[model samples]
Target: MKIAVVGAGLGGLSFGACAARDGHEVILIDKNDEPGGVMALAREGGFSFEQGPLILTDLREDEAVGGFLASLGIHLETVRDDRGLSTPDFDLIPPEEYEGPDWRKRRLEELFPAEKKGIREYYRFYDALMEIRFLSGEKKGLLNQLRLLRAFLTVKPYENMTCRRFTEKLFSDEKLRLVFNGILADFCADADEVQCFTLPFVNTETAFDKRIPTEKKGKLYYPSYRYIVGGCQKLPEALCAYILEHNGRFLSRTVAEKVLVEAGRAVGVRLEDGREIRADMVVGCGSARDFFTELVGEEYLDGNYRRILRDFRPMEAVFMLHLGVDFDPSAFQKQSLCYYYGSYDLHGAVEKLRSGVYHRGSDGYLIYFPDRHAPAFAPPGCHCVTIYTVCPDRLREGDWESRKELFADELIRLAEEHLPGLSEHIVAKKIVTAEDYRRLTHMKKSSFGGAVPIWKQRNPPYLTPVKDLIFVGAQSESGGGVPIVLLGAVEAYEKAIRANRAEGKGPAAGPV
Candidate 1:
């Protein structure tokens, strides 16, 4: 069957590659000159920077992304990170900082010396809750939910509450509350908004069950994360090469204007240039909103799908400040990723962000000193640093264009607060606003992917409403992250192929 994958991002490229290998003629199209959507990379002044998705998590052990890449003859080096929480004053720290079974206990002791016992019990309870879910997978039905309930009753019934409420119950000190609630910031959500069922998985999954090695000072995992040799662009480039090698064609700088629907099934896409390419299936590697509302047209969508697109808010857009600095690596602290939260009010921060406002001091900030992790990112004496914060795509009740510089200055100011003289070391800098992201990738509001990864919305079962027109990417069930997008592409193509074959269709009838 001939398949047309619109938007040659990781998801689209992955689908094209797999479909071509599965004996389908595939055409992967993107408006950009290259693939890789958000995984795109930029280089300047002897420094290379990833445009998006800096960290790679190895979720499932067996089909780990590293193994998948190896299967494709793409080798990647891994860097283990040892990261933890530090107080606003940078004095009080987590127990993971010290080491021992009592590390969490000790850390809690330092934060809430009065409520040390409660903290320890809380950790144990959270761990147990995570173990049950990991062991039981996502409960599917009333029976499975009953099983989960039974397990919770037997182990930790307190898991039923929200993390914010639970933390309040566990500790009285606001600082301790901040430390505990700060963990939710990693998910770009607040403790009250984030599901408690996800806390354990996130905690263990992100921390990788390893203490921050005193030598490394960040979280460590068995399979380390290595930047793609040249940059993240290499991944998409390699995947595109693989697809072409397998007889798949890619159409770059081409936009799919609309999904060509007939007889209640999508048969092809009409390009903005007025060219029509027919296909047995169309897989959209774009945002849910764009795919449903724009390409397919809201008139064709059902209420539930439209509501999901309408009511379902996207994750926050990020304000990224990429800097090329002239500095010695040894001159600065050796930290890969450093998160700073000005206040413990994470929920309030998220609420403000949802409404397209920046939270005061609560702006989610991440400082990436790539030279500390991968020297290849910069020259011998220079360093590359990126300061990122979650912000709404559009400002509330004002023109974001007019306020873009102010936003950028605010980020720089925050960076200055953290790294003194950081501005002086900057040789080059670029700011990526939500508008820039939207213009570049066609993502709605330049939103980051996978804001919500609940159990019900987890994988292939989360298909779009349109018949031949399928959806992938962070907005789809697979959720964001490189590995998930890759997996989503493969799964979507597989489904398309099976459906096409069942219909006895051949290469889709259309102009090449």
Candidate 2:
């Protein structure tokens, strides 16, 4: 079987690797000259930075990712987070400050110490929501039914409520509410608009009881979190190399302009240059919107899928300021990620953000100093820092093109307040905005890719309306993030392989 995968992002590469190893001839295509998609590495002077996700966690508890890297003879160092906070800036709080109960509980207590019982009950409720255990029918009990009924009546799970609503109900402290809202920025969604169910699930996946320490602090590890020493891009590069070693081919700088469909089945793809490559199975590791509406043509799509794609709102975009400074954050002697609450009212902060207004008084900022863990990321006596914030995708009155410089300047000024004299220590600095992201990655709205991962929309979410064409990646059911994207690729390949075998073809080759 000949399989063609569009977009050589992590998802695309994973699909290619899986199919190639399964005994099929696979061809991976991408418009970028290299793989890794948004996960690409950026180097300027002696400083190296990860353009997209800075931290990688193996949430699935599977050894597939790490084992795959080891097969390629690559050894990755595991890093752990010594202290956790709701925000990115770690310099503000002391290590002992996080010592009481879990941060979530502490945050609740801080917010509603007067309503301590209510706050504790809220945590208990959140815990119950996260504790999902699949039991056989024989194990059913009346207690479980009562619990389910209570949840359905009080939780209002069907209302699509936001984190703000939950926080308001659970606590009244202004600072605590802001702390909760600060984390909401991480999801790139306004707290009031983001579904409440999204919060607990993300909390479980990222900040549960799982905490491991490495040789360095502020780095996190799971059973499978691994890094490709040269940088994260090396993983995808290695996967591409493996495919080639197994007689599979990778075509860089080739964009899949359209899906080639014959008799309602995906035959292959037509490249941007009008060259058509035929394949037994075609998998799209790109946006579902682009795949169906632009590439596949809306005529082939059913109304439901089209409506879903049209109505789905993408996650908010971010503006990142990557700086190479002459100091190591690890040596600074701070122990946790910091969350600075510049505003007293969390709802006001969210409203300001949604309205596309920058709060000039917002001293509250998120900052990450990677040199605290990965020293190899920077030169001697220097550190790499990424300052990020969720900004409006479009400037007020659509003047972003003319106002970008002003925005960058304001961000730098904001950083100067936290890292006194930070402007002088900068050896290299680069700013990436939503527009720049779109131009570079070609993702819609330049979004970080994919919708928020909530229970309602898990990985491999809706089945595409088309019979043979499948969608994967952040834009599909995988719900973004590196690990989920990789898993989505594997799932798509498994389905494609099964379909091929059902058509009387043999299994594709496995990884070499």
Q: Whose lDDT is greatest here?
A: 1
Candidate 2, superposed: residue stretches over 4 Å from native: 59-75, 82-112, 133-162, 192-197, 204-230, 329-341, 344-364, 398-401, 453-463, 501-512
- Model 1's lDDT to the true fold? 0.67
In Å, residue 40's CA in model 1 sits off its true spot by: 0.2
Error of 2 at 39 (Å): 0.4
Please give each candidate's TM-score. 0.84, 0.81
Q: In model 1, how large is the Cα lDDT of residue 438?
A: 86
lDDT per residue (tens digit) for residues 1-512 in model 1: 67788888887887777766656688888998778888776667777777787766552223356656666666655555544445575533333344553465564576567887767766777655644554364437787677676667644566466777777777887677676567565446667665456555455423522343312233222233344434567778888888888778889899999988887788999999999999877888667777777888888777777767765545667777788888652344445666676776677776787776765335457777765656688877788888777777788867567776776677777777667788788887777778878877886667676545533333323355667777777777423677777776666666765665576765433221
* Residue 31 Cα positional deviation in candidate 1, in Å, after optimal superposition: 1.4
